[model samples]
Target: MGLRNYLSDVASGVKSLLTGMKVTGRLFLRHHKEKITQQYPDNKDTMVYPERFRGEVVMPHDDNNEHACTGCTACELACPNGTIKIITKFDVTPEGKRKKAIDTFIYHLQLCTMCNLCIEACPTDAIKMAQTFEHSVFDRSQLIKKLNQEGSKIREGVE
Candidate 1:
């Protein structure tokens, strides 16, 4: 309103600008001294992901290409969004026992939120989050990966 008041407001504005500038100046001066961001893809060799980083669900296979899934349906039941589907069948053993085995383990990545609830629900640790992040596909159907291969047997000693 008055000349003095206007001059005081101008001084306050200048003081705030200087305070902000000081912080930026400090950051700019230290920018070259320390690493702020990683040049991804270029620095893939040096990139370190966290141990618990949930990337994608993968059924681990042993050296014999056998998985640990026992068709328990715990993971399917635990999934809130119905991302995982376990199609099981009764296998007649040599002793004529009706053993349950998974025919197909369909994982719908589009519906999965990566909450790790399925992993937690698994009693045998059959399914887990793999460290692979390169899951981009051209077709939406490609995201629905079958965990178990046809005629694949469950791994021995996997309980």
Candidate 2:
């Protein structure tokens, strides 16, 4: 509007530009001295992920591919979004005992937010987050992973 006001506005714009440029100039000068990125794949073995990194879910297994899940359903109950649907079935043991084993441990990754509540609520430490982050797939159905192998027997004395 006025000449004085117009000149002040231009001065403010120039000041802002110089301020931004100062930061960029500093970063450019220090770029060569600092290592900002890692050489991935090569350094993957030595690489350390942050403690709070949200990766994919994986059921922990022992040497025999047996897990400690007792079909407690605590994780399923803790998941607010119903991402984890665990179907359980009772089996009559040779000693005439009705044991609860997980029939199906279906995890819908598309519906999960990696909240970690399910992991915490698990009484037997059945589930945990795996560091494998590459879960991209063309089909939506591929995102749902069955944790338990087909025809796998639940470990005895897991309860």
Candidate 3:
């Protein structure tokens, strides 16, 4: 009985091993036609970013270097992680009326979770999610970026 049981165990192990090898052989043959792995960085130029992919928030500036942010602090208020900071300065118009304008728009990329809350909260369509996710830096301060450029002013007719 013991010899019969040992022979049955050996037969079962051989069957299992043969089944696994068959699957592997099939995969090895099929690999020529179907690629299962992607070579990243090498395929970066051919990579296509899908729509609705939220990577990072960026403020778009036109040729005149004007942005749509009115410094309403709506983005700052919507950020649950406190990743956005809006510094405002009162601009004196020719009529001497003080108008609020954005001085600096600080975005802490380290703390941002890319939740798209700030983009959705922007009323002026100033901020939008950019399709750029590869943002790695050695220094933490490098992660903190100012979205607005130097000498950039609010776009005309954007309240």
Q: Whose TM-score is greatest here?
A: 3
Displacement of residue 4 (Cα, Å) in model 3 is 7.6
66-110: candidate 3 lDDT, tens digit per residue: 999999999999999999999999988779999999999999999
Deviating ranges (above 4 Å) for candidate 1: 1-6, 157-159
Model 2, TM vs. native: 0.76
Q: Give TM per candidate.
A: 0.86, 0.76, 0.89
**Candidate 2 lDDT over residue span 82-151, tens digit each:** 9999899998899999988888899999998899999999887888887777678999999999988766
Query: Candidate 3, which segments miss by more than 4 Å at Cα?
Result: 1-13
Q: Which should have the higher TM-score, number 2 or number 3?
A: 3
For candidate 1, give the lDDT. 0.88
Question: Which lDDT tens digits does candidate 1 get at residues 1-159?
Answer: 999999999999999999999999999899988886789889888888887889888898777878899999999999999999999898787799988889999999988889999999998888899777877888999899899876787876665
In order, candidate lDDTs are: 0.88, 0.86, 0.94
Error of 3 at 83 (Å): 0.6
